[model samples]
Target chain A: MNDLTIIITLIAIGYIAGTWAEKRHYRSIEKREREFLDLPAITIKNVDIDDAKVKNAEIVYGGAVISVDYFKRILAGLRNIFGGSVKSYESLIDRARREALLRMKTMAPDATMIINVRIETSTIGRKSHKKSVACLEAFAYGTAIYLKG
Target chain B: MKYTARMPETNVNVTPTSPLREFFVLLSGVIAIIVGIYLLLGLALNIIVPRIPMTFERKLAGPFINSMASVDRSSEKAQTAQKLLDVIQKRYAKLPYTFTVYLQESPRINAVALPGGNIVVFSGLLEKIESENELAFILAHEMGHYVNRDHLKGVGRALVFIMISAMLLGPDSSAGNLLAQSLNVTEMAFSRNQETLADEFALNALHGTYGHVGGSADFFIKLSKEANTGLWGHYFSTHPENLKRIAHLKNYSRIHGFAEKLLRNIPAIINKKRPA
Candidate 1:
């Protein structure tokens, strides 16, 4: 094909791909919202599930890390460069951070002080070859004081 | 083909792109974008509004704790407040739950109870309020918290969140597990059923304790305005929607003439001191 014809074809392909990607992103959000809202009620059959150490006023915390896979990280890095906001990492990082604090607090409920917290992320053990799943690990720690301040 | 000079001028048919096609394409693109945005916003608004209570609690906890820590509790108002609480408590002892009142020295006007039996009335609330009836109404509403054991429920709801997260995200990842545990969504988004329950409980206690009809409803009306102005996040966060609560309170006022008078009396009492 001539240059003019080739340019027209490329433009068409770009439009189609952009439309498809936009639609796919919307579909994914809808799916995520559905799953999040549909979560079943997690009942505690036994109330004593609270860690004994927390009740005793001892400090404690928990951590975990999951790999983000190559593609996701590249996209995340691109998003971060935009500077205004990074919403993709929001759900992933938000979930990770909140869950860590919760477990530690539950573990040391009576403790008043929960300080010296730390969080880290890495791709060291990530199965790079896998395309379906991404992973990251987070760690949290603090002193738990059982005082009613 | 030999007559090249004479046949040089030849028309080449080019089916030029039509403006109509351009218009329609642009129209479709705009429509697609509008529809996409509408759907996304609708979904988010639905989820966000319903779960606001969970967000409210999470946001309020730190501020409340900080405020509590900063206030001085050594004021003499504590004794007087405790006395008033004793009288109110004794009168309502026939009810299902015990009521306790704490006189906090903070300057902000507020009184509330935590899940379990923790009740607090800010000195600011007392100082800013106009009359004994208003104060009594506030106390009664807080007492509703104890009767319902809302503090314990608050804690229970937080725990439920942790459990839910654990179930959804396998227990293997410690970081995910810990982060999930930190969120206190239950406090922000009380089940719609729970919001209704608390309102009913407070309304019932209002009548039982004060023998007045409109006092509680009147307070709600005032509170609704404050909420709209974004001045009362404490009440806004914990209580049901201000307008909804006011409407329910109005309904209660309709059934009880005494409450209607009390409601009417409130504006008069507050207004008597001012020109308007």
Candidate 2:
């Protein structure tokens, strides 16, 4: 291989080594991943969803997911900087809407169907997404508890 | 008598400055005003920007040493004398590698540390002092620089100034306008809290090593007297008057009862030699 290829390989190795070292050091200091003991209610800004009785009941469990392809589209939108339609992140928003439903489904006691479901959407800047990269990668989650009548 | 034939020197006959000359003068005056305004704006921006705390150690100290050449020519001697000073430093080998001292042959009774472990002391300060404890106290204070990582923090702050100046004003600005951003050669006078912490650290070292907390605190009182007049008083741009610092030290020793404690623990601690 050429000298440039060799140098690039070395740099890649060094980067991996450095990342590993930092990970190891932090792991040594604090070995356990902190458990999530509490979660706050999620809501769209300004608009209130009217399911207060169901929502007020303690939420038990919830999850969110987006197609891997959809995630790439969202990332591309963020990278476009001064370009691209930010609304393409709707996949993430949809996932969050689904998770909110799931949280209620899991928490509710033998509940059949949930009603008065609502979802709202907004666009965040490219910089904001970078600051919360883990959250940006997929979708969001929330829950609403309910009882089967 | 022909009035037209009158030779020179008549006030009325003086040639009036031309309209073109007047326009050029007005243009020059306007240009000068614009330049002055630009410089003032740059200075204002430099002051308003806050310094960031990044780990820029060597880059900051290198330029500071170069700048000190204008104030004192014997920086080379100062650099060389660090080896001799290391003999004194050897007494505290348990301390980390970061603690160091440099002796510059300057007439001013000043000692300061650059960001990173770059400590510079004027030899004149040593000449003026009578006791070894006084020298140890000053060195210990500078050691506080290394322990507290003052250099790294200070440089970080200065870098923030440079970045702001580059962003708001062009980087290639005039020297006078940038002087506000320049890192002063003396260790930036730390806050009262920081000063107290350093003094306390030195007091501990004094009591622990020589069993002489009184000597260390008394030296501060002497320096406080010296600092009231001549070059010493003028040196501090930010630190409180030395008398105030001395008063605090005396009170600290009295309240802490350092001397008696030193006497109590001397034999056991001497044999053990605890890590500083």
The candidate maximizing lDDT is 1
Cα lDDT over the full model 1 = 0.49
The TM-score obtained for chain B by all candidates, in the order given, is 0.53, 0.56
lDDT of 2 at B149: 51
True contacts kept of each: 0.00, 0.00
> DockQ for each of the predicted structures, in order?
0.01, 0.00
**lDDT (tens digit, per residue) of candidate 2 on A1-149:** 24335534544554455335434633432221111112123343322335543434432444443222322342343335434343334434444444444444445444322333444433333354443322322223334434333
Task: Rate residue B156 of model 1 by lDDT.
Answer: 50
> What clash pairs does model 2 have?
B51-B157, B52-B156, B115-B151
Runs in model 1 lying further than 4 Å from the true structure? A1-149, B1-74, B93-98, B105-110, B162-195, B226-228, B256-276
* DockQ versus reference, model 2: 0.00
Tens-place lDDT per residue, model 1, B31-141, is: 455345534543454444434353354454545544656343344454455554566677653444333345665555566665323467676566556555555566666
Model 2: fnat (fraction of native contacts): 0.00
> In DockQ, how does model 1 score against the reference complex?
0.01
For residues A1-118, what per-residue lDDT tens digits would candidate 1 score against the true structure?
2433553454455345533553464455345434333221121222232465344434377664433433334344444434534433444554455455555555654444454555
